[model samples]
Target: MLSIVSIGLVGLPVNAQPLYPTPDPDVFYTPPAELAALKPGDVVRARKIDTGMYVGTEGWQVAFRSTNSMSKPVMGVTTVLLPIGVKNPPLVSYQALINSLGTQCNPSRSLFNGELQDAAGAMLPIGRGWAVSLPDYLGPTSAYGAARLSGMMTLDSVRAVQKVAELGLANSPVALAGYSGGGMATSWAAALQPTYAPDLKLTAAVAGGIPADLEEMALSLGFAPHPGFGLAFAAAMGLEREYPEKLPISDQLNENGLWFREFTHDACRRFLLFHGAFRNAEQMAASKSLMDSPVAREVLRQNSLRHFDGIPSVPVFMWQGRFDELTFFPPVAEVADRYCRAGARLEFRPYEIAEHMTTAVAGFADAWNYVEARFRGEPAPTTC
Candidate 1:
């Protein structure tokens, strides 16, 4: 039911269809051969970021085709930054703590033009002579809590960015790093890489404040004192977008819940805090509780990191703040232990920080050392 218009711009085969809605889903479906034949790291498009005071750093907004959680073809965008003088440098796929439903907040947009608060901070890697790939990861739809999809996008972004000749990263070593929501993507990507994108050479990964188990996260944070209630809600809302058939969320949500859903469409972290007051899924769902819903239970189980098989083939550095207000330490620790048992070369670091916000900064130096060593071909220490 899409209307066609005559706007001639070149590269047209007389009968070719042009996307009118800017991300008309039809565009993603087209040229199946191109998407299917996409090598793990094929570069689709790259455009330099022209704004902000980015000294000695050249940034690009890249878009590439990657598989979604369901293994369906999807288009993903990332922000790629390179140091002016560095050539063929090591790459770090830094997943930002983007726990927002708004599409504008994704790194491809917000961080691309250096408009968000995290923009300057993300540039730190470029300063280290490491080319950085900051993927929107969540896809064009902004599937905020679709962990596996985000992970796939992360790995694929690394692949696509490496192929960019201008970046000179054709054979560059790769590392993955993120905290909190970003950690969810990092951990999932690491665990999935062995089977999902085994062709890529991943040197190391660092995940801090990881929400390893979503079910536990819901139970522990969907109440008072824990501010993660909003995050949990956002996750559910996001998952619904990705797995609409499996989740069928609208049928389960009450009037108030539906209102919340509409309100969250363009909401970001700052707005989430106030909405977090609901504290419980029962307050949102018509079923009275997420535990009482079979669909919710199944979705939570499937998305958890522990449900997966082999861990990363490369070294992994995981850290958690013992008193993290958002991601409780115990579940994160337990999952790390599970990764260790699965024979992953894991170094689990626990800090005594009182909360989640400062934990990211506290663990920064250690993460840097770990990844830098991996880039230098140094062996990773293991607690296994």
Candidate 2:
């Protein structure tokens, strides 16, 4: 269990803000006893889908018990889309970039209501007769940027799909793919699989334009003209949800900052990016350095995917744009090198004509082809 103790106002006087908003107890967050008793990837409930989530696909939206960042039990929902006329199809968990601060923006919910933003990307695998599982990787609370929690939920979603007798994915080959915020989920799931869910036996994992180092990205986007400043601030709020005691954010934020923080709780990623672009993070928190506190440093380090030493045992394909506006290329390159040095089979590619958005679009073909090849039992090509 992760213990997070608040480091009360140190040489600073400020009003204490509410650390966390109280969520409704009757809804999605209320975990069943079966969920807590089950292991990380155990199914809590399986129900037939009646929603238009995946318009062309017909499958069940399963609710499964998953482990959180604190190793506690939590519930996650996943839409399992099986190929229309195929049997025993290969499984792929398509982690969409749902970078919202609200639960309503989750891909699972969007799929049900037909509001998914990445339907085009999801169509690639669904069109190829591959079974795709779209997991609400951020889980019920919309813990955006909480990579560990995302990864755990993702892995558990796959387990839930496989366990559902109606899905018939028992012996199917599994692959993973995502980009941007979704990439963070894919990367963490891949890295943690070897230890956390070794039985997953993931064939290949593809991540593009990944924000591997959250701390670096947070600091990098702290200044003007960069929409990342808002996104970074959102991440800090997300982290506070996971480690409230450690990030007593309410105490540090000024009155204006407090309002901004609360207002963003239900804001979408698009709204956040342009909401307060170019604002300095220090000004928002009234701190000289966001990482000044020991608690802050530890929380940031713990959440950073790049700092973790786990090397994915499965073949990994990582693609980054030559110039990504949101996540700079240096840290992405550094992570690729780190994985390669850790003796993992990794193919790291940088696209020439790709910006952040274009890289995801340009790399989709390659990413899908890579996963397709893996499902076909072909050996993954490695740059290492």
Candidate 3:
């Protein structure tokens, strides 16, 4: 069990933001005691939701059976949006960069919050008369940085959609796309698809601002509290949910770390950025460089796209900034090259003039074109 402690203001800012209902107590999001009986992608339950905020779109929140990082049976929730007039549309699983530790920040909840960027981003695909699925791929606990769990949730989300007859997406051609945290999920789904869910008709994947090495991103932080530390520490806290024994995050925290963990459990992306702006991982950890320890190395390796053995069976289009301050460019480039050499059909683009956030705008058009072509059954381009 993870322990909770108190931290005074000197440790970290105590922004006690109100928490929305977490998964366990929330009736709609809760899973049954044992999921072992169900197969991955099995629709556990589903309920229609209002998409009135987005004109001419119908939506539903689906809870589907999936596997956790440990390959244990688990349930995941995804929000599916259908264009009001489209028939037999192709499916696009858009993994939102849900870089938060709170269940309230999951796409299922955020998709309705027009204020959030990803909710608006989902609109582009829906406007194209495509079925869009925004999965809370982080699992029931909002396991933020657990990529394998996210990947399985992503692929299984596609399956859940196909099984829902009312959605009319039976066996529809599928394409996946995401940026940053979502990119990690998209890449992991690509790498794990062949063996994990090869039955689906996966066409292509678009991964931008990819963080290929989980450990690199986690350990690259300095001792000082900075703007980017929130994302990193959130990831560390997120991973703790998946591997509590191996990663004693709650147990290892000093006063500030304890405060961070508590505040983040109920916080969202915006709060994380503002609160962690002046803090770093060293402040939370008892052993300053604990992320470099052997246990952390092994756990991070298992979740990282760079260390994965297999590549996606479908074509891939990857884009990144030349100098990304957050998810660095070199690691992403290396993953692209490794995939190319492994006989994977890939197209890699680097926005030479862009930075982390700038790459999103600079690379959007090309990524859109790639997804469009794949949906049209056009041949995939290659830079390998």
Candidate 4:
């Protein structure tokens, strides 16, 4: 029996909230035993409850809390398993890529900065019928710790979902999928899964236009057009959130990295969209020395997925567009090559005609087809 718990219904008042510093953990909730055992076909709707954050075996488990927009008392659902059985259907986790600065602030929109409502303004298709746990892993850190927190949040959410499932809350296998920054999160989660959630049975991961190497991406975007500047700003926020010591700014950027944090939190996404690829990391930093400094390098290193080595515990399906001017092809190819060489069950699909966004949108069908085939017990494609 699937059960839905309605969490708190707080009005969205325009208040200045700190970004980099972590929020109060009390705001979240853990899945109760009764609520966790929700089955694939069962559906229960509750309102004004909270899915508290639980510390997973790997890292901190972030809570994905949201109020149902339509109903009073804000009904929020938890662990609704979609029946696509294969004994234990592989539990697929969807991580939305980074699209805008304030992306996470809006519950109606996707973490990838896509609209939650469709053109008809209906709730966007959230892989509802699919056996998947799509967590808004960005949490409150969307504008701050974009990549690292995203990775941690993604992995922890998978663990959280698994925990709920293991307690007889849901029944399914596990896999992961994401695009752009989400792709980055999925990559990191895959890398960490072997050590983090070894028994979760993650069979595959699909990521598109993944920003694997943050440093290279930052450098690439730092000098480009207007969009680069927005990326740089976003990177700064990420760096400040993940590694506070790396910030060069005295008080605003410094002081435990929380003071002027709010300024960048909501602003970063809009800045990126408005600027749209004009500037890069080099341009964002006030001085060239800061750009070349070791701290900067360290910040870039921490945000990147390249530092994590070894093939994932599960097979990986990665796609990138040759014309993807945003993330580029070479880096994507390099990561794919490395993973393949490491004997990963890797399917590196490149589209000759598609750009970044178009490639991801167009490739979803193929990606899902691959996922469905795997879920139905189809053999994985040979790496060679």
Candidate 5:
């Protein structure tokens, strides 16, 4: 059974139902009725995708028409749900570093085009007629962590598009894409479609600069110095969301571990931006003795991608830069090898000159091309 602390209702733990629910309708703010008739444009507006728990919150499911094709629709989405204040938008708001952990450290200047730069370094608009963006802040399972929940969130976002279509609001073919953490979500959605939502036709998926193996990342970051501290912070937050049992603290922590946990959660992007300049995880661990507990080790063990049992059911395109310091190449290679051996169709591409940032930027074009071909009813491309 799931439990949710009702918002603004102090000390009352309510039994959360399986289907996502709405907060108190009386207090929840509904979108202005005028927004229903507005077409996609420069301004970002607040709109409710569903009625229940997803209401009141800034979280929204929005539609953007594709410029290239009137009939086709592509969905742009992310898992970060909180309303980003202009003074302090959440780290996930930045499109380029959306997948990276430390976004809050370096906030972007432009809200509309902050992280949406393409390979050529030009601004891409969320115009009427090409792709619809769904800021799926509810995340997978309307919560974070647990890969399967993330997958469900992605699938549901697509379902949201179909729901809008049924109401004569919009229609478009969906090409799911996300970078870094968003990439992980997209990958899970593609893989889970065969069983979870087989009726939804997912043309293709693009997962660039993916951190396929979380455990390896933890192990690597745990042993590294400064950046490792940041990684440890990310791990703690991820574990807390996915596997709270592994958290050592019961009633919220106050120690160095807790301090780092809060700091990392609040400033994940800052840590990533400066991770390479600092020492690896080992140096930091030695100084702080952060990983001294068995619980920390167990968190790494549980959150690692190695714990996953099978390859995704659909064809996947994975790109990794050889020089990526944040997420190394070995674990990604291992995942690709395992999936390929499992007879799962996978296109694994390695960029010799690409690092974490460049890998996603450079590979995104190809990823989109691959998806376009698939959506045109072409056969799956050969795995590289």
Candidate 6:
């Protein structure tokens, strides 16, 4: 049940949740002084909050203990939303694709502000009386591209909720859901769950728009000035937060690259899309060949979702747009091939007309249905 968790709630409450974004306070997210003594899912503190979610829900902001890319203790925030009339509902950790370097972009804050990143993905589950967990899988610092850290936070968020006696979800069947950035986090959580947090009841994982390989994307992506290029640069900057010693942005960037950093440091996903609209990513760096170094390769390799020691312990449902601009389809197909060869239970769906952003809503039916079937204890279907 993964019921081994602790919670300390405060009387703090948001007075009429802001309709606009607000700064994420450090007081709730700061790691506890006694972090060394706490476990991964332990809730440091929780606050009751109001959310304008499409599905009627009662919400709470949970700050829980989770590990980072460096395997050090860190605190992350997740919003636990229960359907107003559901009782003892199954749980789904909805890892929204939060692609910004800004703190205000986190889902815990964004949802309350009436911004739904992929609410369509959660509608079906919540409609069928399923509890939803919105985790900031990138951690409180928004380590956007750190694969391992994102997964760890995802798994820990589930564990945090199972222990909340007030939520009444003890031993509930759990599923993981996300798109793009959230997809990367969902895949990693599936890979890491067997060994990391085996006590919980993990069912199926629904992820769309996952970037299978970062190292390949780094070396091969065209350097032409495009909106997509800005995303790549932003990911590199995000990676630096988790791997400062390895990425070394300040040391590697030229004058233009420095401005790119300042432009994106606190920028949200929407702003990041055009930060490099006229600037070339290759020219931004002091040395165009910086990504060719062995150190850089190793770092990217460590963070790529393409390579895993073994197949995930649980079933996975993956969907991607054939013409996805953010995360291409072939690499994802290659990963699917590997899983099929390994005899893992994977259902990979490729959309003919959907792109990166549209695939989440385009394939929401299949994704949520897969999760619902799992919750019903139905036999998992495979497309291997």
Clash count, one per candidate = 1, 2, 2, 40, 30, 0
Question: What stretches of model 1 exceed 4 Å from their correct place?
Answer: 1-41, 112-117, 222-226, 278-283
- What overall lDDT goes with each candidate model? 0.72, 0.75, 0.78, 0.50, 0.44, 0.75
The TM-score values for the models, in the order shown, are: 0.86, 0.90, 0.92, 0.69, 0.62, 0.89
Tens-place lDDT per residue, model 4, 44-134, is 3222222222111111122332221111111122232333222344456776444444533333233224443211111122232344455
| Cα RMSDs, all models | 9.0, 3.6, 5.0, 11.7, 11.9, 9.2
Model 4, residue 331: C-alpha shift (Å) = 1.8
Provide the lowest-lDDT 10-residue window in model 2.
1-10
Candidate 5 wrong stretches, greater than 4 Å: 1-129, 137-146, 166-171, 249-254, 260-265, 271-303
Tell me which residue pairs clash in candidate 2. 53-111, 224-278
- Tell me the lDDT of model 5 at 18: 22
Q: In model 2, which regions exceed 4 Å deviation?
A: 1-29, 51-55, 223-225, 279-283
User: Which lDDT value does model 3 have at 380?
Assistant: 93
Candidate 2 lDDT over residue span 1-384, tens digit each: 011112233554443444343453434446686667788787777776664545667777788888877777888888787867798988999998787777656775676444567867876888898889989898767777688898888888988889988889988888888998889899889999989998887889999988777666655553344546667667766776765555666577766777788878876677777885766554565554454467665666676777888889989999998777676677778888888888988888888854688888888888888888888888878787
Candidate that scores best on lDDT: 3
Q: After superposition, how far is residue 279 of candidate 3 from its true place, in Å?
A: 1.0
lDDT of 5 by residue, 62-157 (tens): 432211111112222332223322222211111233322322211121123233233122112121123334343223212233345555545645
Best by TM-score: 3
State the TM-score for model 1. Answer: 0.86
Compute the lDDT of residue 84 as modeled in candidate 5. Answer: 23
Candidate 1 overall lDDT versus native:
0.72
